[model samples]
Target: MPSTNRRCPTVAAPPQPTDPTSRKLLGRLSLPERRFVADALRAETVGGVLLLVAAVAALIWANTPPLAESYQAVRDFHIGPAALGLDLSIQHWAADGLLAIFFFVAGIELKRELVAGDLRDPKAAALPVIAALCGMVAPAGVYALVNVFGSGSMDGWAVPTATDIAFALAVLAVIGTSLPSALRAFLLTLAVVDDLFAIVVIAVFFTSRIDFLAFGGAVAGLVLFWFLLRRGVRGWYVYVPLALVIWGLMYNSGVHATIAGVAMGLMLRCTRGEGEERSPGERIEHLVRPVSAGLAVPLFALFAAGVSLSDESIGQVFTRPETLGVVLGLVVGKTVGIFGGTWLAARFTKAELNDDLAWPDVFAVASLAGIGFTVSLLIGELAFADDPVLTDEVKAAVLIGSLIAAVGACVLLKLRDRKYRALTEAEERDEDLDGIPDIYEEHTPEYHLRMARIHEEKAAEHRRRAEAAAGSRIEGDRPA
Candidate 1:
């Protein structure tokens, strides 16, 4: 039997360092990471567009005179079985239940990055990790500073700490068409770390009390989940019901139910077995990502983003310190923290920005990171759950801040895009003069031979069609 193992073309060797000690930040990706980033960007781009539409619809629904009351009524309507303590408002269901799927997908991504992707290397992971941490810290600090002397409570500090991967990717996909793939990879890595931190903050800082028995049950279920995956359990029927049970237990335990999703996701195997095309984690992520992006996240955004944009509400967003803090944290703090942290890492460590990118590119991407819509809204709601007025104010701030960031990133990235576009055109012109197709220029001899074989096959098909037509005409005169 022949061996089926093959090296993927996308996974090329990293460029050798000119200096032994110096490392490149946002370097070329391995095959799996490249494929993952491509797929994720595609999904998140569509998801981000839908999320924007849903948010806009929500705002219009909430602020319109005739539909405002109806919107509130629908969001507040109760559903779910009460016997198992699952009853919750429609809005809560979107938040606690649908968002779990989103986090579950996130967990799978995190696991893959940690195990098989760039995050596996300590040196490679350092830049994004440091940047993500600083990104979170700076926003929280800004929020705290604003709320300390102001009338608003400081509970909403974590609200601005999140970077919405979907929205950020969407913005990048739009404005950075000619930008380096390294920028997307950097943003994806930074967002993954940012998500992990956000989950931890939600679990630790937000939970008021824990029901020990329920918490224990949730842990036990997680163990069973890991055990089943280890044993090569394959059926969704078995895992789906079990996952629900775990989610319910986690919710009842006063910890965030989304944590259950993340736990299960982290436990799934990410490394492929011998002769396998993809790992179990990758398979599951592929199946669930569409559901999470298309349905779960959009639904969550629809329910969460409905804030009144009345003059009074708009006034409160600017006047209230906590709300104003959220605005500044997302716009100014995210920009400064990410760019500053990256600069610090490059300056102090052996790491340097990739040759394909520059300080301005990093700055633009950092600005794009400030579009903290989905998770920021979730944290805002959790922070100000008791204060509806404050929650609305925070939601408004998130929207306004994200909008500002989006616009700023658009302007910056557009300029970068034009520059890169001109560079690409110049390179293409040179390639054309060399008599080699640009696509085949960097391809290996093996790849060129394969493509040659494909072309020969097409030529053979054309000859066969011609022969068949000639034969048909000869027969037509004799038999017709």
Candidate 2:
């Protein structure tokens, strides 16, 4: 205890971390970083919900007269240098740039799924991926077929192919547990694949002719980043600088700058817990949650969902090919295609139908999948931004489609819920112990008698063995 008297090594003081939430507010942080993490999660949830509300409000505001003009003026406000300056153009920056973060979050989610969750098992993942592929390809084809002959509107063919995760989740929450767990898992998986497809579409089809010099610069930055990664550079430092250069260069290179969102997520070497620690998936999820929910998604919603509705616009929206096509494709097409595709995949392929989900329940789940609001809005903006009229019409279509899809899912789920309730009660009351399973049936009198006879025979054999052992002991004693 008196090490001070000896020339022993001096003990070092504990390191102090800056920006410690608990230290400032709640005193010493609890082990496992409980004090900060829980607050962050809660804050993210509140922020996400608030952002959704804000987006909806912006939509309302954008539809108003003088307010809409003011909003547009503010959106057009420039940031950055004079000649090198960038104007948000419209309410598009918040949606495009901020929503990039949302997409980055989506990328994180995809990574987590690949490492674990439903994507962990390849056999299980096959059906959802197939269903998603069909759902995407079919809708796009339908849109393309309707708009063939090199029509100017052909750019929006991918509009309806999206599945909005938030809108879908909202529908499912109302629907409750009448739907099978497997069906929900499938729906989630499919949406992720749809996101991947959307990213490709943006990168390949949407981008204009590339500026090779700027592209080359961007490539150089990425290569430099690769070396930095090898050198153990922190993500915040590397990605912050990396993102500015990439997005900026991509913007000049005739590529939609938002592609940088997904690219950044892909580059980060996802870190996990150390020896006997939690998974990297959990950590990445933690990091992604706030940025995506609190900031990126809300900002996107505000920007993308802004549409000024008037009598003229309403009349035009009904006739706009871009408008009608997206509405029909998402609302009508998604419901039928998802349900039908999944059913066929289960029957024809190695996948099984969700055993607990009746046909009615599957129908409900399919309806929920039709809520393509967010991604639909995003793609529509990218697809037809130069044509404001089409963009306005698309905004209306997505709103309508999301509403109809949500309503249909709610109604179908109600009916399915009643059916499951009746079936469950019937099974519970049945005398055959939970619907006549052999495990329960095997408890019958005849089965017990058969078992009892076998047990008696075995007891008799044990007694005979004991007698034989006693004889052996007696024989040995006599000989001795």
Steric clashes per prediction = 0, 1
**Tens-digit per-residue lDDT, 24-64, candidate 1:** 77665554565578788788888987888898899999889
Scored by Cα lDDT, where does model 1 land?
0.85
Cα lDDT, model 1, residue 416: 64
The TM-score measured for candidate 2 stands at: 0.72
Relative to the true structure, candidate 1 reaches a TM of 0.86
Cα lDDT tens digits, model 2, 37-97, are 3333344436535555866787787988769987777666666544543554545566566
Strongest candidate by lDDT: 1
lDDT of 2: 0.64
| TM-scores for candidates 1 onward, in order | 0.86, 0.72
Task: Determine which window of 10 residues in candidate 1 has minimal summed lDDT.
Answer: 9-18
Deviation of model 2 at 378, angstroms: 1.8
Clashes of 2: 1
